[model samples]
Target: MSTPLIPLTLLLILTAVLVESQSIIPIRYDGFVYKKRAASTGTVLIEAFYDPVCPDSRDSWAPLKQAVDYYGTNVVSLIVHTFPLPYHDNAFVTSRALHIVNDLNVSATYHLLDAFFKHQEQFYNAQTLGMSREAVLDQVIGFASSTLGNSFKSAIKSGFNDSKTGTKTRVSFKYGCSRGVYGTPFFFVNGFLVPFNDDDTIDYNGWRKLIDPLITKKQHYPSNIF
Candidate 1:
């Protein structure tokens, strides 16, 4: 005997349930835990995939920080993902160093990143400065040590090669690749890729234009704020 067919509405409900389950499921990967500047409830989420050694990434830093400061954590959040491009000889080491710092002190990660960008010329421009890659790496590490302290330096020396660090760095690269990130300083807003112009300048106002409306519409102000 033939079995009775299920109702179409029930099939539709099952399909919807399956789709929702898949959507809510998180993507899990080994290595470094992903970090975010704000809680997931924020209306605006900015995902930045950047390489420390990239000039464009360095240039965008100030404007990005400004946006974070302006919105704070209530309306906006920033998730930083490291994407160390191959040509930047010292990028991987810097990325690894940043990962180590994140483990030790999450707050210091951005400070070290600022240090790297501020002195990119000194370290990344090795050929121009007549310095070797090893020298550049040492300089970067030294900057981290000086800015963060002895423990950071010791961690770098000891844990730079730790499998966990390596795994985190690799996972970052892979995550970027999966997201169609081919270059440094890639930006995504609320899961939508923000189109950047073909120029070195970062348009902070332009970003504000995109972000402000979303905040006005969906973000509820904290009860304490008058």
Candidate 2:
């Protein structure tokens, strides 16, 4: 009798075969999914992939703020993807908490970003070097509860634990990977990542150089959000 053509036969054959190949994957520029700020006009969109706990990001916040003010609504700013590394304890929780604020549509997200910069040490004990995840969540939820209603607390918790969060995290990681980002404070302007260096003393100058030309050319003007 012929051996039965069972599932094992197909499985064995497939296991033996090896697939190897490399393809030129298209690099997804920022414009693929991101949109300009509502008030933006004749202006460029700036996507800043940053981690709240990153010192480099904190240090650059001053200049970033200045730049935003200088350009006003001429430039759209977006903070995407908070990657909390293993070395930085509770960093993930901090990010998760912030995501909660964002999901809740609480303006606190931006305020929290500023707070995180100034009081990161409080949240992250230098000696202990990490805040309790639950504690941080409490702080975020408590602040949001007053205006957003208590539902925000539960929703944040849900979103934080939801599968969508992971998906968004991966998308952010993929975008960063495509842009050759190995660190935080990664900035992208007009669908292209800005090439800059740490302590390059050109943070403001570089931004001005790249954007001024475009603004002058009438590629971008300025507008206000109503």
On lDDT, the candidate that comes out on top is 1
Model 2 per-residue lDDT tens digits across residues 27-106? 33322112234434345666676666777777766766666567755444444556554355556666666665665564
Per-model TM-score versus the true fold: 0.76, 0.63
Q: Itemize residue pairs with steric clashes in candidate 1.
A: none
What TM-score does candidate 2 get on C-alpha atoms?
Answer: 0.63
lDDT scores for all predictions? 0.71, 0.55
Model 1 scores what on Cα lDDT? 0.71
Instruction: For candidate 1, write residues 1-226 as lDDT tens digits.
Output: 0112447874575455455444342245322222344446545778888788888888887888787778765667777888887667778888888888887777788888888888777556454367766776677678789988866787776667588877677667766666656677888888788876646555689778888888886745674554
For TM-score, the strongest prediction is 1
